[model samples]
Target chain A: MIRLKVALAMAAGIAAISSAPAFAAKAKSEEKADAAPIAIPAPPPGKGQIVFFRPGGMGFALGCSVNENGEKISSLGAGRYFILVTEPGTHQYSVKSEAKDTLGLLVESDETQFAKCKIKMGIVAGRPDIQPATEEEFRKQKSLKLVDEDDMGPAPGALRPAEIAAALAQAPAAE
Target chain B: MLAIFVATILSAAAVEAAAPESDGVSSADATEMVLSASLPEGGKAPLSDDPESARRDITIPKLTPISIQILKPLGSKLSKTGETFPIRLAAPILVNGVEAVPAGTEGMGEVIHAKKSGGMGAAGELVVTARYLDVDGRQLPLRSLHWAQSGQSRVDTVNTLNVASAASPLPIGLVGFFIGGGQINVAEGALADAKTAADFSIALPQVSSQQAGTGQELSEGDLAVPSGAVPDEAVDTESAAADVHQGGKE
Candidate 1:
């Protein structure tokens, strides 16, 4: 009887351990399905916006983190993008890896701009380069996804996800 | 002596005027030339619209292409990143077959990137973007001017030479290191086409309100704010109306 009880407890423990991964996998898939599409709204009055993206290509394993000043705004993984609303003025963004490249943009009120990051060959590892891009170029990449909220740092100047949602809600619906 | 001096001055002026010119006007003369060209013919009023039609606003739709010329020479070697240069319209902006913004209206262009040629066969590069056109003392945003150019690259030639020299002991490939890439240069008056960045609504200049029964002209104060100045009250009303319409849609 003792041996049977011990055997039963071990089997139960093994079953729970085995089922945990499957349950986690199911939850992850559900979350992904719920977050399929992300809509970006027009910038508010007196503000300008920029969309930064990284298309999956060479150096896919490396992260292209956009930084303003010294703080990390967000990490642009392979095939990911993020929108940042900014004040009307000059803004400089930089990406660093084995080397660093910077791009400066003159933002105006009620304007939307785009920037793209690509990996280039460097002396050590691949270097990240940021350049001015257009809306047409951005749309060419068909499989772009929104950067995960967890990947963002304390970007005080940027619009948060909650703010984006509120703005989208206030925007007029598409016909 | 005075006659000779006057003759010399006249000859110099004649030579300058008769010189073979390139695309656009000189930077120093751009504003004056544009202003004089845009002025009303025969010193008449600038607005040609009838008094009744002046009350309406003219909308310049988005993505309307405007031909512009750079006022000065630009190049990867001469330009620095983040610099703004003067530009002028090469053609007039038409609305309903009438000239709205005339040729020579001043605008601004910004250098987004400028990299001089570097060693090791790297080429010089330049990228410039149009910012806005100054129309009636207001900024009409412009965009889609992705004027970019790169100098000739010598990487392949350098690599070939290096491979050929590898078989010999003289290191002849080292000559490739001295060869520099070309520079991109946009001469004065070069065309840099741009498009309207967004929908721009310009308020037309309104005539003075006629004094009823007196047949007298009203004072300037009674006239609707001159061209392009949309009243704050009117703006607020428009915003309110837009909000109401959006709410109704929801």
Candidate 2:
């Protein structure tokens, strides 16, 4: 009887040990589901838009601040995105730290574009690089959130949280 | 044909305006004047008058596949992000039985990301993109050339060796943790494929413009309209604030 009891106890302990990781994974997925997804709206007529996002990775503490001609546009944190509305023309976007990387894009009217910022190993620190991204790539990142207003630059292009909400409201409801 | 020709001229004009030393208006005006002089009203554009101005438009449709050959060797440990390399067309772009862009035309490629192998069995990574082709002093943008590669990861092998060592009579505890991954490398003359980003109408000289149709004169309407649109100012702050509060609740 003692031998049978010991076997059952060992089996129970094994099951608990295996199930703990599954339970933790389930809890993490549940927590992810709890965060509401932010909505993106179309650019107002005659204007172009760019969605700048930085996915969470090795350099989570680094700030990916986007700039235009040396003027700050927004601080793109890890796992965060911001919308910048601008005139339809060729615009140059840049990010810098120990080094600077620039991406030139031809923003078109009534078109939505995406730029991805990645942190790579630099000589002294992590360097942020911006590259053109597609909409499919943008949708693949599920943990994106709107940037806080305090992180925005003094520039007049980036949409604030309030502006994004209003734009979403004004956008005709998706069929 | 006329619409595409006008658009190409305007595109060239835009490139001129974007130059650092350009005042934006004079160069564009000069381009317009040159275009107007070459194309008289109600007359077919002089297709073969001067070798320089004898170029005719040939529309390279969007998404046309292009093969390019890298001119130099590149490696994750040896390359840096944003570095540019010389590249050449590996094959001629045939449009309607004629070579539009020849095989020897040179272009530029950019390194998007390069990370050398690190300690703890981390692998090296490299990514590159085909930026553009200089087709007769005009920049023909290319896209979809995103190529990524990773070095052979030593993690699995190191783990197995470490486990075997730890199980030995004289155990070496986790010695594999000091090992590093391989460095990724791409040899010179490597072939890559990319596609035209958009519908680009390139000017081919009349000698090779047998299939090209007659070009049209540049018109005032053909000029690119200056982008004057500003951001929308109207915002429903109250509703947005409420929505933000609701999001917080979530």
- Give a tens-digit lDDT track for model 1, residues A10-83: 99999999999999999989877756554668888778788888877666788999999988999888788988
TM-score of each: 0.51, 0.43
Per-residue error for A42 in candidate 1, Å, reads 1.3
Question: Relative to the unseen true structure, what is the C-alpha lDDT of residue B40 in candidate 1, on a scale of 0 to 100?
Answer: 46
lDDT of each: 0.69, 0.69
For model 2, the stretches where C-alpha displacement exceeds 4 angstroms are: A1-79, A84-141, A162-175, B1-57, B61-67, B80-83, B90-99, B102-104, B112-127, B131-144, B147-250
Cand. 1 Cα-lDDT: 0.69
Q: Write one digit per residue (lDDT tens) for candidate 2, span A93-173.
A: 889998887776656556677778876554456667666666667778877988889999985868998887788889851
Where model 1 places Cα greater than 4 Å from the true spot, the runs are A1-38, A157-159, A172-175, B1-66, B71-78, B94-101, B105-108, B116-127, B131-250
Tens digits of per-residue lDDT for model 2 on B1-250?
A: 9999999999999897566345544444444433333344452333444554433455788778999998889998999977999989899987755578999899999887777876445467677777788898987888766465557655555546655775897544355557777888888999998888777776554332233222333211121111211112221223323322332232
- Give the DockQ of candidate 1: 0.06
- What TM-score does model 1 achieve against the real structure? 0.51
